[model samples]
Target: MLAQVRSIGSRNACLAAGELPGGPWAARGGRTYRTGASGSTSEAITRARAIRSVTSVRGYQEVGRADLFIQVIPFASPEDARGGLTELRGLPRTMPQSKGLSDVGELRTVAPPTIAGTTHVEAAEQAFLLDGEHSRTLTVWCVAGQTVVVAALGGRSEAIRWPQLAEIVEAQVAALG
Candidate 1:
């Protein structure tokens, strides 16, 4: 899986160095998510053989030095990929506990920009109180072909906005095509 995704390289990179004003996004190593002593694949996915593999690429944005992780999960078939989308949405919400700065904010649904071959798109965001600071994560996921592409941005006091993430997600899907 590492070789497969590593082969993607910069041509599929979410953000280029110096593409934005605050210099370039630094490359971070990526890892594959698997189930077992070695890795994990959820029972549901295993049952349907829906997922082939899960992998992600990360970048640290210069301005806030925030982390941007784009996870790509491809399935055996587009139908299974669609089911995987619903499964992702169903994962238990383990919201972080607040330490009195402010409670976690409500999730707001976001409308993803149109992409060709996308059968589904689901996006939402919620803010968390981190060390008395406000931090939010915006996730935009889409289903194209037999793959599900997800972009998760978080950990910085300054939030990573939608346009930036969307650009990355679009590039990723395009590269897969």
Candidate 2:
């Protein structure tokens, strides 16, 4: 199933190659970036392979620290795929911390794009301040058939290309079929 994910080009790309029907992911070149159940949560990625079964891939271009990233995964069925997309939609929330520390990040769902083949989609826009460098994260999850694709990008450049995140996910879905 991984073989059916996006493979932009086998040359000059960091490939997260694998075999199996996994969770949420991003595809670039031949690389497959596994996400939090396809979710973009520390709790999810830090857990296990089954928890992190989906995918991941870095930027296809320079956009924060390379800004954009995404994942694409195919499950055994649409139900499984919906599960993946739902997980990804579970954005980060305020976690209790020591009195001295605080979380400056904000996560919320924006409007879902009208992509042609998607069965469901959730778009999250996140923003935060850390060390004075303002960064924004745009994460989008789209479930089409038995596949789910996610695209997330942050940093100063992300706002300019934010609209492309939907385009990117739509491309991934189109590729899977």
Which model scores highest in TM-score?
A: 1
C-alpha lDDT values of all predictions: 0.61, 0.53
Candidate 2's TM-score:
0.58
Query: How would you encode candidate 2's per-residue C-alpha lDDT over 1-177 as one tens digit per residue?
Result: 433332322222222322111222333353544434344444324432343344544444342243455555555457777875676566444423324333456677788777768988887776664445555667778878766677665554334355556655665566566
- Cα displacement (Å) at residue 138, model 2: 0.8
Considering every candidate listed, which one attains the maximal lDDT? 1
lDDT value, residue 52 of candidate 1: 31
Query: What's the alpha carbon RMSD for model 2?
Result: 9.0
Off by over 4 Å in 2: 1-56, 59-66, 91-103, 130-134
| TM-scores, each model vs. reference | 0.67, 0.58
Count of steric clashes across candidates, in order: 8, 16
Per-residue accuracy of model 1 over 7-65 as CA lDDT, tens digit each: 54333434443442333666565555531213336553563333334444545554454
**Which stretches of candidate 1 lie above 4 Å from their native place?**
1-23, 34-44, 47-54, 57-65, 93-102, 115-117, 130-134, 155-159
